[model samples]
Target: MNPLRLSPSRVNDYLNCPQLYKYRAIDLLPEEISLDAERGTLVHTILERLFDAPAPTRTPELAFALLPTSWEEQLIARPGLREKVQNDKEWIDRVRALLTTYFTLESPATFEPTEREVHVEVNLTESIYLHGYIDRLDIAPSGEVRIVDYKTGKSPKPGWEEKALFQLWIYAFIYWRTMGVLPKLLQLIYLGNGELLRNAPTEADLLRTEKKLISIAEEIVYSIENVSWRPRPSRLCDWCSFKNICPAFAK
Candidate 1:
């Protein structure tokens, strides 16, 4: 009855496993957030706050300084997180190391981002609306735009990069549709491994991605109406919070 609202993540969830999709999106079940997800949120918050200062003032040391406050708030807001951080000083060290690795790849002071964690959305069709937050957006003097996403984990291996690149393409497609300009660059920064992955999306590439997303949307709608969302068992299930209640693994 309502228009289908979707984000890149929601689409990917359905594509990965419709049953998982139904559990979270359709049934609106609750699941515990992971420590890695909490850490990623903290890192993103620190990076966003880092750029709030003048470009010259956006140094790694300042970014590091921002972490204690950011982390304290996280622990307070999510008291469950205290146990994870209380005894593990290395956890904080690992986050600081990620900040250091970020400096090695690019200087925050070099280019001021037009937006950070920007919420961008577009209506692909009358029934399908796509939306998501981009980690950062940069515009050069010459008018070229760049979309950047940060990964707290390692970069995917050779063949696995396709999925990562596909995610970028989704962002580019949404941006182009919403803004009427193709971005000059799409980048992923993997802090764990200090690796950078960049791509320049062609009009044709984004069009293909747009088509794929629409198709995915249609499939999701069909599954929801028919109550046919089925479980997809895979290695990822080991990390899935819903596994305990999942139809495929239910006791």
Candidate 2:
């Protein structure tokens, strides 16, 4: 059997609902194109390319200028995506606002990112591998590493912050296992509302995250072997694309 390939998003799918995972990861069903998700992709692309220029030139105006070309590139990659936006002008304006908010939080001209859209992969075991693309990775002058992720949406509410940080903790775990160095910081930059969430993960925290991931992977394997993919109904189901065919909602 091939090793179970897992990303933070894929793992979250399983954790959220195993049956939803089967539809996406196993059955490979097509999901409805989300305008918000596409917008996030466009913003991410512009930000990634923005760093290519000299630090002094990494200004919000430059980021705004890159929008048209970046969006055209996205249009080429996903032809059908354009139709989903009812108002092109309004949609582009929203993207511009996100870039403007980003500048207020951090001056990209001040520090250079060690990596952007960096692909990270590490094997947890012979049968399980963890991998994903990190939005940004920065190495401080003192050698402390920081993992940063950009969010086009609003920050999660107070009690749900830990749940939101779970994704980054998984990334931290992979970095530690592969690089033999624990990242000193994990940061989430919420462009929608201009809020920042930061965490300093400890060694023990990442170790627990690793164990949890292993257990989830094992559960996935067992479900595959047993041919048991059960739907988990929650408020999130309202947004799930596969709800119409979900067993839990079947009449």
Candidate 3:
């Protein structure tokens, strides 16, 4: 059996539709470029760049100034976006709205992050590796650690938050496994509406998350050995690039 590399996003993809997972993680099928994806990347890039300035110099004006260059840098990396968005000015303006909303949530000038875009990986088992990139990491003088993630989309409503929490749980598990200390806070900052969801994870919660990952890894390994990846059709199918090629969508 080949070693399985499972990230939070890939785990979500597999749960959403195993066939989609096979197309992506296994076969490496190409996906149609999405404007929303490009815009999200642009916004995230600008936010990350905002921290590159001196802590005192991190301002909304500076974040806005970083946009054009960030967009240009993104364009160079993903030139396909140039043909996707009809009006670059309008697109940039939309991204500006998100950046403006971000300032309303937290003053970036106030907090000095210990790390940005931090990549982490941990071995779940001999055959499984859990890996992900954290948006920002903050450490207090008191030895408390915080994991911060930025989302360009709207915050999840009541019962739907579990889905959003899943990624943070995985991050918490990784941090605990690697550092031997659970994070004091797990945060998700939604730029769409200036909403911040923060959770102080307990030892019990991390243990539960570890149990969940072990179960997920077992399921993935079984699926791999059996070569059974079924499709799950839902609203998400509407936006899936492979819908035309998927059996669930076939006549």
Candidate 4:
């Protein structure tokens, strides 16, 4: 009867650095929510309102203006990012344009929605874990569902598909189990570039995902018993926020 539901993000932490995961999750370090995370929240809020609001009420241009300048401005605080965000003004504009495009690309005939925030608490055999709302969910006339996740970040690569894309699979399974209908699309809409990545999971696809999830969970649980771990050093060390305290990066 454990009320714990796991998400891909928690797994990502263990994958990134187990020691860091221990400090944050077990020791309960004071959480430092990043500016990027905050911006993501804001973007999610705006999109949810736009998509879930009545069809007549949706306005992409309005959401663009609605984004708080303070939150957008605060992205300056990240190291080596003040100039990067500032330089990305054009990029932001392009992203805004893409949002508008989504509205046009999906409105007037797209499934009527009010952008309602949908959160699901799955018992999972009385293990009460929660999954947050998808950025947008469109239920088409054919009873097929589409789960959209908004990503403003730049594309990680041409090889992201094979390299353990746990999140999308999690969402796909969640949608399938929660809603009886099959998903027509599980999409990552890169708001910045209007790029879309999608997958429709088969039984085999999901079985592989389940295996991967279980493997990562086992690693995380094993790391919890001890504390002798350190940062992953290499080029990524230069960018890790934990470098200030990481043994591997000790100068």
Candidate 5:
């Protein structure tokens, strides 16, 4: 059998609902792309491009200027995406607001990212391989590493912060396993509400994350072999594109 490749988002899909995973990963169904998600992609592209300029020139105005070109690049990559949006002007305005919020949180001119959209992959076993893209990776002067991810959505409610950090932990795990160094910090920058959520991960924390992933991978293999993709009903189901075909919700 081919190696089972898992990304953080794909792992989240299986954990959310195995049936949803089947539709996305196994069946390879196309999802209805949301305007909000597209806006987030545009903002991420602008931020990544912002660092290409000289550090002193990486200002909010420069970021704003890159918007048109960044958006044009997106349009070229995803043809017909513009027609899906109800109002292109209003949509661009919202994206601009997100970039504005990003500046208030962090001055791009202050620090240079060691890597942007860095892809890391590790083989856990002969058959299971884990992989993901780190939004930003910074190495401090003292050699401490920091992993930063951008979230275009609001910060999660107080009690749900750990769940929100799960994605970052996976990245930290991959970094640590591959680089042999634990990241000193894992940060989530929420542009929607201009909130910064940070976590200092310990070696033990990453170990637990690795174990959790292995367990999930094992369950995934069993589900595939047994042909038993079970639907997990939750409030998140409302936003799922495959709800109509899900056995748990079938009429």
Candidate 6:
């Protein structure tokens, strides 16, 4: 029997390196998730909980104060890889300030969060299908949907608008199809730096994304069907959390 499989993040890692993907996702390696990743998860949890509360009781101010304190302690306990670039004080203060800035910048009055977690089997066609979890979906008073995905680190090619951003585009489209209404917007929040980036999803945008996904999926299916893949090395191998055990990066 085939196991339940493939979350969006895991699928992304597979795109990064199939071997590493198989080792971590399929083989189930016992590797430590990074402290930085843990920190981001913690931050998202606080922000999500803050939003998910009853509108009458929703409190972004309290959340802004509480979140960074927790994160500050976490940073102190496990400085991790960031210790070199920043001292304990700088890391804690900068993170705290960023949270304060985000609280000031974002208008919780404009919308409410519906942190959607779905593992749906989408019918891409008669034979093709897709599965993923949308991190968060928001709704405006005017009934427009919005998708927000949190990113924790600096991406090497962050400026390019088309850097495999198909994930959020598809997320927005799938959300609308499920709800029978189009999303008004989709945003990517770079939490580490508090840079909130916005993109408006149009009909043409979703169609382009759909075609791209099919192309990428076809590539994956072909490679899996024929077992046709070559090992390639790159920047990821050097800094990847899996570098210690990765065959491509092994000393």
Q: Which stretches of candidate 3 lie over 4 Å from their true place?
A: none
| Residue pairs of candidate 2 with colliding backbone atoms | none
* Tens digits of per-residue lDDT for model 3, 159-191: 888789889989989999999999999999999
Q: How does residue 42 of candidate 5 score in lDDT?
A: 94
lDDT of 5 by residue, 49-107 (tens): 99999999988899989999898888889877878888878988898899999999998
By lDDT rank, best first, the candidates go 2, 5, 3, 1, 6, 4
Query: Over the stretch 157-220, how does candidate 6's per-residue lDDT look in tens digits?
Result: 5666666466777776666556667778877766556676688888888778667667666665
Off by over 4 Å in 4: 1-5, 31-33, 68-109, 114-116, 121-130, 228-230, 234-239
Number of backbone collisions per candidate, in order?
Answer: 0, 0, 0, 6, 0, 0
lDDT winner among the candidates? Answer: 2
User: Scored by CA lDDT, what does every candidate get?
Assistant: 0.89, 0.94, 0.90, 0.59, 0.92, 0.63
**For model 4, which pairs clash?**
3-128, 51-115, 52-114, 52-115, 53-114, 53-115
Error of 2 at 43 (Å): 0.6
Error of 3 at 41 (Å): 1.2
Model 5 stretches with alpha carbons more than 4 Å out: none
TM-score, candidate number 4? 0.75
Better of 3 and 5 by TM-score: 3
Candidate 3: residue 98 lDDT (0-100): 94
Better of 1 and 2 by lDDT: 2
Model 6 TM-score relative to the real fold: 0.75
Which model is ahead, 1 or 4, in terms of TM-score?
Answer: 1
